[model samples]
Target: MKELQHLNKYFRKYRFKLLVGIIITMVARIFQLVMPSYVKKSIEVVEGYIGNNILKSEAKEMLLEYILIIVGAALLSGFFTFLMRQTIINVSRYIEYDLKNEVFDHYQLLSLNFYKKNRTGDLMNRISEDVNQVRLYGGPAIMYGIQTLTLFVCLVPLMFIKAPVLALYALLPLPILSVLIYQISKIIHKRSTIVQEFLSTLSTFTQESFSGISVIKAYALEPKVNAELNNLALDGKSKSMDLAKVNAWFFPLMILLIGISNIFVIYIGGKQYIDGEIASIGIIAEFILYVNMLTWPVAVVGWVTSIVQRAEASQKRINQFLQEEPNIVSTVKEETPIKGKIEFKNVTFTYEDTNITALNNISFTVNKGQTVAILGKTGSGKSTILDLIARLYDIDSGEILIDDVPIKELNLQSLRQSIGAVPQDAFLFSDTIKNNIKFGKENSTDEEIIAVAKKAVVHENIMGFNKQYETVLGERGITLSGGQKQRVSIARALLKDPQIYLFDDCLSAVDTETEEEILNQLKKESKNKTTLIVSHRVSSAKNADKIIVLENGKLIQEGTHEELNSVEGYYKELYMHQLSEKEK
Candidate 1:
């Protein structure tokens, strides 16, 4: 009931259709149950005719009337079945849309850490495959379950009317049948949970293999990957067989109970016929018809139970994801735009799963329009600082300010809008060069893309492509060189014309000459913008107005290049190491 309630929230919007379907199903079930009586009447008519109990003319008329009723009932049942099918299918599709939208909207509000700790393929599976399961089961379970109940409700009284003794004989199996279903449902619930988990793991494996195919190919691990995939498939197969075994037991048990009831009905009804206690022909035919009606509802018990249990398992996973809160929330108070002045005062942060701090008591200030360089070792908090500025996560203590206003006081969207970042690995979508450049600014014209591309020193390279601006790049811009993709990303950032620019080793992929040209262009273009660059290369950060060096999440040094070079520290060591490597 609790699981079904969760599903109802998604499906309630289509209640009208569901109600109409229920009505049609009930009408159909009436037509279906009424047919058995018509069959009985037709048999009686035949019996009377063969015995010469009625005139031949009267017998012919009675036979035709019964035949028409049987045919009409059958036709009505077919029509109602069609109506119920259409209603359920349409409602299912709409509910699928709603569930998918809700999942996506919830995902949008989730914390970045959630994505970092989760697998993309698993998330995709929940939103796509898992939601689909809920939809497939949600609509049909309600429709068919209602139909089964309605058919049983309408048939029970008719069974008594047809023959009270036979009805009592059939009712004996109902309790045991209920017990069998309850036990099977519990077993299915447990096993199906395991099945869903295995499927999520399988999705993760498939996703990782496809996304990292290059690495697999480079390392020649295809055979190992295949072996692991085979293991997953085997595990899935075993779980499925386990579920199958449960279903196998259920069907035979159900058949056994129904079969016993039918045998009793035959013995009792046959005795009534012999003793002339009841009308022989019509009563016997009605008993057979009622027994046939019982077959479907009883047989479908295992099937509907499986669908409901699987959907329940999927709902649990989806609900868990939806309940996750974003690590950073909007401050609620909307403030005007800050003046681009930035400061991090005694800020501290630690990732949830990590013992060591990623940033510790970090304090710094960059006045508006200042160009600052961040130099650090691989494990240092250079990128972490950039992420903090973007408010991807909340600070443990202290505050980050923009233009004397606490960042939390400003609207998150507005705060992020004022900033543009180009990470170390400049990611581009599977789009044309012009579209990639205009990503940050959707309204950017071709001329604007061209201008930004030139400023980023990528215009000539883009023109060299066969289709120039219109050439569709491969996924992540794989068709382009690393340097080209980086420059395109830089152009995208520049086109935004943001108040602050964060370049996190954006120039790492280009050659020295091209790097110098891009740096020169950025220096010219960023005259009035606050720029923060995280670079390992000495040439990239050599001319910054101020340089900040970090080691192990702590600031180790802060000065100009000349001042830093005179000091014996990490930056000087990094600079000398790069110089020595160049010399070698």
Candidate 2:
């Protein structure tokens, strides 16, 4: 219960709904308590009519009256129970919806460092299963817990009034029952936590396997994966069964105590009545009914305790995730217009958990409307430079500037909106081709979409499709060929018409002829915008106004393509190799 203290804010948010539910629960319990007296009266009526102490006609009328009263009491209890369920249950659903939304929104704000440290399946568990666990505690656990306690409070006194000695006997074993449940609940809490974590592992395994199914099948690794999956499933089952075993023992223990209490009432109360201590059999009947009524509250102790402990475990996980502070955050909300100038001044950075420096002492500048290209071998830190400009990861030292203004001090959304980046991996959503192209600008016109597609040299391919611009893609755009996906990415970036463009091997999949044509089109279209291209191929950067060559983590050479080609260096080597390939 102490672990669930954070839920007070949610309860307060829907206090009116919670209050109405509680009031209805109280009314239902009161109506339930009122029902036993009718049972007692009905017994008395039977005894009275049998012993000839009342007229048969009057007894018949009284019996019917008592029956009607009992029905009315039952109806009230059912009505209020239904109303309470509607209010409290729906409140839990509403809170779940709000909580999931808030967590997902927070995920978008988190930095790449956080994602690198966490697993996708674990995060998914927090959003879906963990949220449901919290809802169960706030919903049925709270609602039924209140009802059980209230029922116990109202009916216990009535039991004592009917037979004090029997009431004491019936209550003697309750302390033991509570202790037993308390101990079992701790074990349940530990087991439930283990089960949830295992489930997360299973989800992650399935997600990764499906995403890389082609590789798995090519490598013939189905047997190995299946065995691992089976082991995980078995582990989850074992933990669940451990919790279930405790639950199995808990209910019978409650029933054993309740069964003993019932026996004590019949034996002791019967002796008291025979000895003339109890005046009528009706009093004994009412006492028996009260004990029966008390049974559920005692039994529910285990069930609600299980719910609370599960929620406590789940809440701790959720709160820890929510408390994480992002590595990158905007320092300003409003700023002057960007003029497309980008400068890196001796910037250095290393990825988390790795000692290798990805970039070191890097410094360069691209004036507005000028084109710059970064030439490097694999892992020579070409893409890292572009990532730094977008502020995806903060620099370890030094500063990046745009038009003499520090990039970090600029608003994140505004800074990103000023530059259009086409990454090495072409990613597309499962939506219509037009929608994917229009993602950068939601209000883009159809003509604008077509115009950009034509410039990117993908309009003819799209028009050849059955639905053209309305064609929906499969997951990760798997339905399209690699070159088609890259062209779509190019078209999406072209439509943005940003102040600057960052192309990271954007045409790797296309044919050399088509790639050249698209590059020419981009050069024509973005003549006035700052453009940076990062590519391993010398051909891609040959036409740039300036080329910077990198080796290891440092810039080794900087000049125009003609100047680099004239020199006997790595650039010349790459150019000679490509010239030989073209000759073939």
Candidate 3:
């Protein structure tokens, strides 16, 4: 219930609708109460005729009038009930929509470390499954709760006014029912939390299995995966059954109490009439109708309690993520124009998850329009340099500057928008090739897409497809060859035409011939743009304005290709080794 306080703003947002729904619920109950009283009058009119106290014509006329009034009241009540659902239930849907968007927007603001610490499936479940449970609380639970309260307020007083002693006996079992519900609700709250958590675990396992189906098939581990899924499903079923068992107690208990109330009404009212305490048998019928009118609302008490308990459990999970503060926050509000002069002064960063230092007190400067190539072995922090420049993670110690301004002082959005980065692993969405390339520049023309595709040396391969750029790719661009995906990613970055281009070994999958062609085209296009190419190939770095070598998270060498080629260092040795491989 405390966690559910998060929805208060949404309640305030749609307060008018909820107010109308409450009024409608009350009006409907008021109209519905007219039925039992009218039923009593109809029975009394028949009684008058039987005793010769009224003429037959008078009795028939009064009976027809009462029936018409009862029918009219029922119709009006039904109509208002419809209106009540429209207002309250619809507000719940609106809140669900807003809450999902809120969660997704927060997920985007969170840093990469948050994602590294969480699973994709668990995140998906919170926004989808957990939110749905909360919706039940917002919609049906609220609607039924209002209806119950309205009936209890109106019907209870009418019952006492008509026959006080009979009313007392009829409502005798209600307090006992409430006490039992309170105890059951506690168990339900605890079990509901467990069930929702297990649902997240199950969802995570299923999503991972689907995403990595290729890996499972390649490793011939389908049987193992299937067995694991069975185990998860079985456990999920067990938890769900445990909750169902508790819920099963609700209806029978409600029925048992309701039956006791009915028996008390009949037995006590009949005894009172025999003793001359009450006037007419019509009074007993009216009391019975009043008690029966309360049946659904009273029965729904346990159901509404269960719904609220489940909602609280789900909201608690949602609040956990909603309360998370993003590690990286933009300090500047105004957009800052970028000229792409990047500087790293004594930067040292350690991966928070792994606690491995990727960069150790390394410093370098790249002026606007300078093309610097980074050469390094595996885990030499090449990719980390690109990430730092993009401000993906704040440095542990030291400062980074863009255009002579401290990176934190610049608008994060403006800085990233000014840079075009193509990472090592090319990730293409499950969309058409044209759309995937257009992701970098949404409003790009067809000619512009073709021009960049040609520049990346992927134009011919795209033309080979039946639909060319319009061809829809499989997940992560599995429809294309590895080299083709990389080139398409390069085309995307080229289309952006940003001030800084960070190509993090994007050409690793392509052959040397295609790489050379692409590099030559890049030189022409990136004439006055700052470019950083992180690659392992010497051929790729030989033509750069400057090349820096890194080993074991430390800067080892920095020089022009001509200077490094003339010296006995890592760069020259790598060039010779690659040249021998080419000759072979």
Best by TM-score: 3
lDDT for position 156 in model 1: 86
Best candidate (score: lDDT): 3
Each model's RMSD to truth, in Å?
2.3, 1.7, 1.2
Report the C-alpha lDDT of model 2 over 130-228, residue by residue, as the tens digit: 889999988898789989989888877767776778788877788999889889998988988887777778788888888788899999999999998
lDDT of each: 0.85, 0.88, 0.93
User: By how many angstroms RMSD does model 2 differ from the true structure?
Assistant: 1.7
Q: Give stretches of model 3 more than 4 Å off.
A: none
- Score candidate 3 by TM-score against the native: 0.98
Give stretches of model 1 more than 4 Å off: 333-335, 431-435, 466-470, 562-584
TM-score of each: 0.94, 0.96, 0.98
The model with the greater TM-score, 2 or 3, is: 3
Task: Evaluate model 1: give its TM-score.
Answer: 0.94
